[model samples]
Target: MDSEPPAAGIDVSKPHPARRYDYWLGGKNNFPADRASADVVAEAFPTIRLAALENRSFLRRAVDYLAEAGVRQFLDIGTGLPTAGNVHEIAQSIAPESRVVYVDNDPIVLLHARELLDSSPEGATAYLDADVRDPADILRKLDESRMLDLDRPVALMLVAIMHFITDDASPYELVRTLCDALPSGSYLVMSHATSDHMSAEELADTNAANQRSGVPFRLRTTEEFARFFTGLDLVSPGVGSVMAWRPGEWRPHPRPEAVAMLGAVARIP
Candidate 1:
């Protein structure tokens, strides 16, 4: 990805969650530091690679569902490095006029996303250099930029991104704040990394490696993850392993390996 003006407060030396995630997904947007950490985690547990791929599939299916549901606007927080299929592309394909605003603190993601991830003329795609911890900043930028219409129904795509947040940060409240901003019929889609489906040894190795890399993993119980959607109405199938929730003919056989990731899509009341 081509370099651009750096977004403030970006640290390249320490591995970031987005960059590490890019590494796990077989993307080159990550640095060697991230790859080293991802390699260690992958070695400790082989499913890590497949989990990333499955997470992508889950994202696609969720976005498609929202698009088909008549939601035309999207706000994708914790936007990672741009990959093959992105939220804007997927949603806009279903509805050409879909407007999407992707927010991320990573300068690398901001730089690459702006330059290469072009959007349809009728629709709109923009990037915000904001962190998920501060929903106010995100809302302020979105309002000032006018990239998304807060008055209309929107799809809030938070897939595989909230695990980076710890309890002190009040991830549940943050999600509520963002979801509350949308009008009724809006959607909140998320995929969280957890140890619910992993063996004790695998969880230990994965958590240890992540902690060593300075990004600790907190694998929440399904109930804990479900709490993020407290005020929303869960779609059918509720929260499940990404593979089990609307798998959609992607695999010939289903393997019940405990996926560290749990996914769900819900509608805001």
Candidate 2:
């Protein structure tokens, strides 16, 4: 894949979660450091690559479902390196007038934002350099951009990125802050990594590997993952594995547990 010059202050010496994730997704936008860190995690949990692919699949399905449901606006936070079936692409394909805003703090992702995420003629797509932990900043930037109307319903997507936000960061409150800002008809589409399906030995090994890679991975339980949907009306198929979230004929992974990612979609009633 072609790339522009590294943005100033972008330290490629250390592995970043987004780049490591790109490596796992079989993308060529990763560096040696990212490959090494991804390798460490793969050694512990061989299914990590599958999990990443499945996570992308879940994102596409969620976007398609929301678009079909008549939610024309989307706010995708912590959107990593651009891949196929992006939020705007899927939504605009179904609804030409759909609008989407992609947010991420990574300099590399920001540098390639325009090149990878192209908008439809009738719709709009904007990229924001912001952190997920700071919802106020994100909301302010979105409002300033005028890409989305807060008064109308929007689908807030948080897929496979929440695990990086540890307990001390008050992730639940952060999520609530963003969701609370949207209208009652808004939706929350999320997918989180979990250890609930792993054996004790596997969980310990995976945690140790992630720790060694210098990336924080706080795997949650199924029940803990369900807490993210609190105060929202969960759609059918409640919280379940990523592979089982309205799976289509496009199978990305062989087994559900191999993905180890839980997903759910809910509406703000």
Candidate 3:
């Protein structure tokens, strides 16, 4: 983690989803406000840290699967604070020529963008300090990166980020805009916080905690989450719990209800 002070535009007093997620992942780059929000949510959903870890594991396997599938270009949106086993690392490990463009709006993530910039000599990496709501701007920045080719089969990764976008924001449309720009063979890999696995009491407590947390969050149902993959060719085991999405056979699988997070990968036809 960078030892520097917070970026000028960052509001440390207000909790951001990225920082709250980092706290859950046991990363040190978080503020007191983030920890407070995370703890409040944890009180309702005791396995949130486990869910975070599971989601991250899902990301690693997704990237590995894509890389092995010959998808060398990646557009990772809502990229949180860079940690071990990032998109580029996993992809490039399988194919050194992989190219990645990571997008995130967090000021702290911008400050630490250098970690994402380190790329294999045969590949390239670029970080964009942009919001997911602005799909045009994100595509423009990807063009500027000069690494990812829209005509190629790019993997659009939205891991554990869409819950921050409220329903009125048209989250599905945002996804469509990005996918529409990609070629036929492109893929969309996403995991979102879901209420489908929660007990009634737990759901109530989680909703209350999120309302009080100051950061807007929407826990979608499996049906709602599945809407994001509409008209796309869903990879096998489509729209299931993140904990079991193509998890290798080496270890026993955890029950999906334990994480309460949904994940899926779909190819744009």
Question: TM-scores of the models, in the given order?
Answer: 0.92, 0.95, 0.96
Residue range 158-247, candidate 2, lDDT tens digits: 988899999999999999999999999999999999998789998898889999988887899999999999999999898999888888
Query: Backbone clashes in each candidate structure, one number apiece?
Result: 2, 0, 0
Among these predictions, the greatest lDDT belongs to 3
List model 1 lDDT by residue over 1-269, tens digit each.
52333456666677778888888777767776777777777776677778888889889999888888898998999888888789888998999898988989887887688643488888988888899999989888989998877788989989888888888888899998998888898999999887676678867877787777677567787889999989789998998887777777655634646356789999998
lDDT (C-alpha, whole model) for all candidates:
0.82, 0.89, 0.91
User: Least accurate stretch of 10 residues (summed lDDT) in model 3?
Assistant: 1-10
Give me the displacement of residue 233 in model 2, in angstroms. 0.4
Model 1: ten consecutive residues of lowest lDDT: 1-10
In the range 1-269, model 3's lDDT, one tens digit per residue, is 53335768788989988888988888888988888999988888888898999999999999999999999999999999989999999999999999999899998998889999999999999998799999999988878767787777999999998999998999999999999999999999999999997788978888999998888899999999999999999999999998778888778766777788999999999
- Look at candidate 2 and tell me the lDDT of residue 74: 96
RMSD of model 1, in Å? 2.6
Best by TM-score: 3
Displacement of the residue 254 alpha carbon in candidate 3, Å: 3.3
Q: Would you give me the overall lDDT of model 2?
A: 0.89
lDDT of 1: 0.82
